[model samples]
Target: MNKNTTIEEVFQNHERPKKPGALNASATFAWRALLRIRYVPEQLFDVTVFPIIFLLMFTYLFGGAISGSTGEYLDFVLPGILVMTVSMITMYTGLDLNKDIEKGVFDRFRSLPIWRPSVLVGALVVDAVRYLIASTIMITLGYILGFRPEAGFFGVILAVLVLLLFAFSLSWIWTMLGIIVRSEKALMGISMMLLFPLTFLSSVFVNPTTMPNWLQVFVDINPITFVVDAVRGIIHGTDAMSDILMVIYISIGLIVVFGPLTMYFFRNKN
Candidate 1:
């Protein structure tokens, strides 16, 4: 007879470790997502490179045309660019989800006994970190290029918080699309269609007051306009209570609407 401990005896001798709770499972998943960044460093290009390009290009190319000077426009548009850069990056959430689904990892994720929402929630948690990274890069480049916030670092913090809340809420729509969309190409097309009009038609590049009444009406109702105004107010030390409130309301509404939709489809997806 074998004197060495067998697998059966080892199993009998050791109690099973405690099962992970919802928060723990979600955090573990988030860490896994973070580790993915190591092998696919290119995944960070949008969050890293695009913000810098938008700030420099928009400030130099369109600055004189719109705001009469690059310095003034940098002060005016840095907040808007920050919002745009982060907002645009949110689409990648859907793209990545669709990729995982195609690769069949989501099926493995689903089979686990962990909390059902942990997968999506974990991705969103890591995405918040990405948003912060994009904000930091943009702000640092802004400083180098002479953009100054009147409300200073604290105000920058507040503005980024609002932006992150909105961005996280906005990501749910893409998450749903990722689960439902047939192909990544179609998803990218849909994202471009939605994002271009939303970002370009708002107050980011030009003031709505300078446009025709009809265009102004559309701009006034545009949700991006409210976010930009809120950030602008926070950064410039102005009274933007209404815009801030609007952003909060919109973020809550987005989460309430799309959050459940994402989970429903995720549970039912083929």
Candidate 2:
């Protein structure tokens, strides 16, 4: 306890922490994220209110112009909107991590005795729940707006799972950004700037064939387009082998690239 204590003595006196298993450590952090949600219930707004607003607005505003009737457009757009909404909400993983870093909690967490990546994994688990809530709202409201999925309830569930898997993979990219960025605002800005163009420019809003030839090239290759197409296939009970495979490939590619990069920065960042 002396002020003159040497570094060697300090090291000798310090007790090493017993490390928890990966799943246990991650569950701890996941529980912490869920508890924070209870105190800050506004966190639910994006997955709830925002999805509703986007659904109603897009369904009514452009529905007739795009598909000849609101009902017709609702059927076409609902799957796309669901994909976009869940994708947008994935940014929160980065925003929350940035805030934690700024507030100094991230450093404290780093000092804790646990699997390091569990912190990231745990937060991701919570975000998955948020995505589920958003998906449910979009599908339920779509029904009210006459957007029936011919594939029925079971099909809708499959669509939701596919979107969640893609969103989970996408979160790794944001998780890396959150570790690298100086502020939550910067992370949000950069993420939105990238996501808006990808989602809007894809087949989400209109048919790719209707797009200009040049623009159609991008739409045809866009990952969001693949996800939207897969969802539409699931909802309509159609064969979507190519779309589903593409979505899976995109998700795996994201995780393979960003997952390690995020952990590298997370472990080494000052």
Candidate 3:
């Protein structure tokens, strides 16, 4: 062949780039998101600080009025505070997703030779570490504040697992909202508006018995109530198998509903 023909053949015969492995795509995105957390540790402040503040504020300010003594109320309130903290952390899933979308991060990811779904699932996985850290701090704070878990170490761990599972399931819902909403601030506002009422309307601060019959009925059916009660049962030796089952079932249902919905939206957006 002539020199020019040989050069053209050489260029044409060069190997094409290989696609990234599925597992590699997932792991790369997961680790990249997680490493970002180390650089911006302040993202964790709300997770650690909010629980402590809420625990102390509620126990000291209204404990006696609500439960007859600060000590007695701490026992009842800690579980609710723990659940609230997990719920608050889930809001970040949507907020961060919205921020990424706004910044064209998803478009950048699309250009990569990786599984597109990995970007979302990996973010959710990485955020679980933050969830664990927040949970450990909250549980430790409870222990230091004279809140004892009658369920012992294993039960406490189990309760934490359940709480995290619930958080993970809820993340999908927030992920969908984050992608659907046009702005991060709007996502945060809407999430908090929905969460605040769900949390407060339940038996978090006061006994449901004190509420009106109509409100009491609603509180009884709130999923957050079931989660809080399950945690309290595990820690305080209250029989909560039924409540635990309810939480498990509801969490599974949420995953079933939101997981597919998120994937659908994500694919369409891409």
| Local distance difference test, candidate 2 | 0.93
lDDT of 1 at 18: 74
> For residues 1-270, what per-residue lDDT tens digits would candidate 3 score against the true structure?
466677668788768778888788888888988787889988888888888898899999999888889999998898888998888889898888888899998778877777878888788888888888888998899889898888888888989888888999999889999989999889989999989988999977777888999999999999899899998888877799999999999999999999989989987885
Q: Please, what are the lDDT tens digits per residue for candidate 1 over residues 55-109?
A: 9999999999988999999998899899999999999889989999999999999
Tens-place lDDT per residue, model 2, 1-270, is 689989899889867656799999999999999999999999999999999999999988998888899998888889999999999999999999999999999999999878899999999999999999999888888878777889999999988888999999999999999999999889989999999999999988898999889999998988999999999999999998889889899999999999999999999999
TM-score to true structure, per model: 0.95, 0.93, 0.92
Off by over 4 Å in 1: 1-5, 10-17
lDDT of 3 at 204: 77
Candidate 3 residue 33 C-alpha distance from true site, Å: 1.4
lDDT of 2 at 268: 98
lDDT of 2 at 266: 93
RMSD each, Å: 2.5, 5.2, 4.2
- In model 2, the runs with Cα more than 4 Å from the true position are 1-18
Root-mean-square deviation of Cα positions for candidate 3 versus the true structure, in angstroms: 4.2
lDDT for 243 (candidate 3): 92
